[model samples]
Target: MQSSGTSSQLDNPPSYPCEKLLVKPWGWKWRSSYWFVTFVVWLGVATDLLVYSMVIPVVPFQLEELGYKHPASLTGWLLFAYSGGLAIATIPVAVWSEKYDARKLPLVAGVVILIGSQIMFMEAPAYWLMCLARTLQGVGSTMVWVVGLALLCDETPPEFVGRQLGIAISGVSLGTLVGPPVGGGLYTRFGFRGPFIFGIIIAFLDLAFRFLIIEGKSASKLRSNTTEKPNNEIALEANTNSLTDIGNDVDVQNKKVSFVHILRLLFRSQRALATAFLTFVYGIIYSTQEPVISNHLNSVWGLNSSKIGLVLLAGATTIFASPLSSWLADLQGTSVVIIIALVLSVPWYVVMIIDGHLALFITAYGCAYFFASGVLSPLTVELASVARSVDGIGYAHVYGAFNLAYGIGTTVGPVVGGQMYDHIYKGWLAICLLAVGLLGLCVIVAFFYVGEEPIVQSFTRRIRLL
Candidate 1:
């Protein structure tokens, strides 16, 4: 009986499959390393964003070649189709990630879809086929982002969550920065096929990296095998630590939460709803600017695809500040950082409305982008905190909701912004003022309703006691 029990334990280790890998001289042992997982996730996110954004500047030109008379409306619909797919897929993917043992599979599936979408983009002769391609890309993006982030939170120490998320966001920024220039430059020189070819290469790299990732649970099991303690005892201890660590934020009863249950819990928390709202608003700001700015550059300055991409490089530069913004959130709290960033955005909007020179336009847009990055960098951390505070174990679900908000905004922003520009070509100044007013209101809501204590508040309390 003793021998049989020992054999059973060896065959079926108590740790999750993510824990450890067998240590060979080389081979798959690298899966057990934390840096490997982090790098893979970072690259995955960057590549996903890169492929998506690379098509943006080239969309107008592509539509013209495809024989579409009204490219503006078509462009908005195409953008909307992608975000609609993202929003629709977010919840289902989140639930799957939460329930499944193999988190890497979703990532692999996503990359496969991405590759397919790129192929469609390159070869599709019809408009509907192109829209289908963009929608598939969006679905793939949802899978990668939801699963990748949940895996990152699971593997990382709680204290490092903010910093790590910041790094991930920086990767996204880097992709956005590079995509337009590369896509536009390539398309200008080599036509539509050039950008899609480059995207396929990056997608393959993303796949290989995801396949090699080993989760923390698997790594822990491998380490347990080398320890002096009995295998069963090590398993028990590891399980206990994991439960204790997660218990603070997640009720034991709610461990196996359903998708509907996650929605209910999210709405019940004021902070979660507030964060979701802000994410929605941020999405609007991001998606709205893309078509508007691209169109503006083409119409006003008669800039070609290559030159438009150069102008966009200004906005991309602000993404470099993501680490700093995330560190500030860790130190000062997300609410404080969000409020300050929104306040700063007001003046930038005013500058944009003035519409002076090309240099001025780029400067205003860059400053606006910098503030937007500040909001995005820490937004996920704040959402995670809210989930924990509400006794929720569904990190994937929380982020799924955040993405849903963003996806909705992306879906709506381009359509509305595009229509507004079409009807009122000279009405951008009025639109800027309206956006500023809305941002101001968000700041007020964040200050009053978003419940986290800022670093300044903690200092004040300590001073009062002294």
Candidate 2:
């Protein structure tokens, strides 16, 4: 509930070890519930991504063993199934979380994931059945990601929201970064079902933790109760404030609208709508490229699983750059940084298009990922700012929309690229399509989606942290 004159309060950073975190200047506050929930959610997402990473490398070997002649085509279908499930399930899960308490959603989703992973381990039928199991995993992932994030927001205070979100999302990036090598290593030695078995075990462990991790609601609500009401009661007793003081309290409550109303409003909002568009374009380019990248290295470069794992690690370089990217966004605004990053990504795509040079390939890929990584967090932050007055779950829906779009792109990208490479370019076209799609998306994002407007322009430039 920022003041009308200082809505810049919304953009301030939380107090943390970093000097840049100024939003909560009253020193960093800690609550045990927040830390526990963040850890559980991060672990849940990280494990899921790690399991997914194992599949890209494991799939080709497994399919070959299962008598599939065309591994690439089968791989495409499996990826499509997984991403499609995620896209379809995200909104429904969000709606479910809104209707019920988030506490149960994680527990249920985790159980479903455990069941799906176990099925994947036991019933490694043909390619199609594998896809079905992955699809179920996707559904469970959507539930966990959306519901968990919504719950995180519900439990966090507004002042420290960005920092908390930064820490939580880093877990996702960390999972994606680490999953491939670990999964690939296990698959290299133990076989395809090994990772699935591992994933199932981890999913079960996560399920057990869900019930143990206390919900975030009590902390946020309790803080508000202990701090807020006393202020109101004091003002009422003193009678020192004018009618405007009492009216301000009512205004805050009035702005707190229903979840559906917020969704409808966001859909209608130009800024929010543009953010969604950026998300869609970003998803198509980014997700479409991910599956095939490792395959490309394996098939084109004649690299072993361990070497390909190292190449995948190169993409994770962006992880180190994310906090700096967020800081740049905080300094210069997300819109500017996003547009610049998109423009810079064009040449990186060119490098990917010419994959003969290994150095060039890794360099271009790293740059492309760096820009994407940099823009990712800030984009969500900006969109959240747009819908700040809405329910905490509203932010999750916005994020869910982006994930759904990304899932669609990811589903289509790999299959199409894989088939194209298998049939047409003799393995060259896969990278080509990824590059072209990415560059084209940069154009759209720069010119059509995120115009030359800073998100914090109309708000305060600076504010007292906390």
Candidate 3:
């Protein structure tokens, strides 16, 4: 019985099982390097949140001042253009990184952003130049979104991958919490250049960190070049094959897969993409809420920057709950946790739509987002695992799709919400209703497709509301 119990534990491992759990191990240990990579990648996430949150609130007003009425269309296009860059670059970046290294991409992107910001400073009067600058930032955004995530997957073991991802995602949440208040304050005080200046400083810092702290060989194939190998082993291998034979073998191995091959692989399996579609829908709603919610408070409630920042800060504080969400993902599973999170959001949206007082509104909406982002992390982890299973190179493409969904939401939300505010309900309720309805759709999708497991059983058995 004791031997059987030990065998069972070995077969179905605990989520946090580590070096101490196992008696025999087959691989070299590198905990310090893993943590270092995690820190650097987390910083990259910080850069993304800081830069994006900086511009979103102010972009519409900036465009409106340029005598561009009906600004929503232009805003939509600008966001789409940024996401478009991410989409177009995703597959190509993956392919390139297969033959090269991804470590330098973030540093390169930071340099571009710095130069772009400086140019924006020089050409502040031109609207098109501002668009160009944003596009350049988008290029860097794509790199951080893809490469940083891939590194997380490479660094952690399978059981702990979800938790590690949760930690990394928390950085983005921290940035979200910090960026808006800082940007809004700077905008209130320093005018248009405030956010851009902040981003430029962050870009420089990110570049320096990437160059100085992160070693290339730790995360790249460059290590393979330095490790010593037996000469006789190499000679026996070379002697076993003719030059032409070796060339043919290499050619066959390196043969590029067709786009259809990739599509088929993803659709044929149950991996990230299946779960990612749900996330794509959730992202649309979540992205729309950010700028629109703040805009609503400012336009309707007459809130100042400090008050608005406080409102946003309330929502941002939900980040503190991410580790708890991650724990839930481990104890249950991502699929079950996602369903619960989305279900909780539906009521939050309903509350946001109806609540007139600032305190009540922030409390309700913040609670929703707090739970919503919790769901978001597990969903991303499952999606990344999906891509990793399908093809080692498809991770960025998956993220590109995810980003594209967010871009769509951010792009459309302002325009749609603005139009609703002006024409339909003449209140923020329309946008809130839309968010509620979309979240409802997500719940329906989850019920039908999120699947069953130890995860589903645990959720149903432990947290069953039905």
**Number of the predicted model whose lDDT against the real structure is largest:** 1
**Clash number for every model?**
10, 2, 2
Off by over 4 Å in 2: 1-32, 101-104, 111-115, 220-263, 389-393, 430-437, 443-466
- Each candidate structure's TM-score, on Cα atoms with residue i matched to residue i, is 0.87, 0.76, 0.77
Question: Which residue runs of candidate 3 sit more than 4 Å off their true CA positions?
Answer: 1-32, 60-80, 99-103, 114-122, 213-256, 391-394, 408-411, 451-466
Q: Candidate 1, residue 232: CA error in Å?
A: 12
Worst 10 residues of 3 by lDDT: 17-26
Tens-place lDDT per residue, model 3, 322-400, is 6667778788766778778888777887887764787888888788888777776776676666666565335555564
**For model 2, how does the per-residue alpha-carbon lDDT over 193-297 read when each residue is reduced to its tens digit?**
566777677777777767665455434323333332333354343354446557866765564556677578777766667767666666566655555566678
Our model 1 lands, by Cα RMSD against the true structure, at 5.2
Clashes in model 3: which pairs? 272-383, 272-386
Q: What range of 10 consecutive residues in model 1 has the weakest lDDT sum?
A: 17-26
Order of models, best lDDT first:
1, 2, 3
